[model samples]
Target: MAKLDVELKVNGEDYKLQVGSQERLLDTIREQLKLTGTKEGCSVGECGACTVIVDDQAVNSCMVLTAQVDGSKIITVEGLESKSGLHPLQKAFIEKQAVQCGFCTPGMLMSALALLNTNPEPSKEEIKTALEGNLCRCTGYQQIIDAVEMAAEEWGG
Candidate 1:
């Protein structure tokens, strides 16, 4: 297979790499970039566990080809924190006990961040809609919703 060279920014860092034409963004993120924060649940874009922010839009890493993201900017769960502290959503999730088993936390955070980027003051229903793609096997989702809402309030959204 011919390797394609691509450049992209991830979590505010620039990177240049040679990727296989068939490489999925999920694989590049996990294997190459070592950003395991984006989970791979359903590879076909159903579970939303592989969600990441590309150009400020939430996307399923599994559904995107690495070459398709050349020159794009992506934000993963790993990028949510800063030198000051954890992102508001992360803090809220901890406070609300929204994480269970930890599998869905990354995707949930990505979706919530994307929601805030666009609709900072999302209503409960809007929050639910934004997270519809993500599936949490634990907590039944109320805590996640509460976490996002709390984060929104904390961010003055």
Candidate 2:
């Protein structure tokens, strides 16, 4: 099989990579770029564990081909932190104790980040709708919703 060249700006960094034709964006981000914060739970996109921001939209990395998103900007869970510190969403998650078992936190954060980036002050229903794609077995989702609400407050203020 031939490889396809792709250019992606991920987590504020640019990368030029040659990837397999069948390679998923999740694999490229995890293997080539070494960004493991994006998890692969259900490869068919049913589970949002591999959620990431691509071109300002929240998408399941497992569902996208690296070649499909050539020249796009992407943000994974690792991108949430900066020189200043953890993002407000991250801090809110911790403060609200939204993490448990830790498997779904990355996807949750990414989804929430995508929402907050666009909405900044989403209502509870909007937050629920934004996060509906993501699944969490722990924390009961109430905390996650609360965390998103808290982040929205902090983000708006």
TM for every model, in the order presented, reads 0.97, 0.97
**Candidate 2: Cα lDDT at 107:** 95
Instruction: Output the TM-score of candidate 2.
Output: 0.97
lDDT winner: 1
Please write out the lDDT profile of model 1 over residues 28-136, one tens digit for every residue: 9999999898899989988899999999999999999999999999999999999998999999999999998999899999999999999989999999999999999
Candidate 2 per-residue C-alpha lDDT over 1-157 given as tens digits, one digit per residue, 9 for 90 to 100:
6789899999999999999999999999999988888999988988799999999999999998999999999999999999999899999999999998888999999999999988998999999999999999774699999999999999864
- List where candidate 2 sits over 4 angstroms from the true fold: none
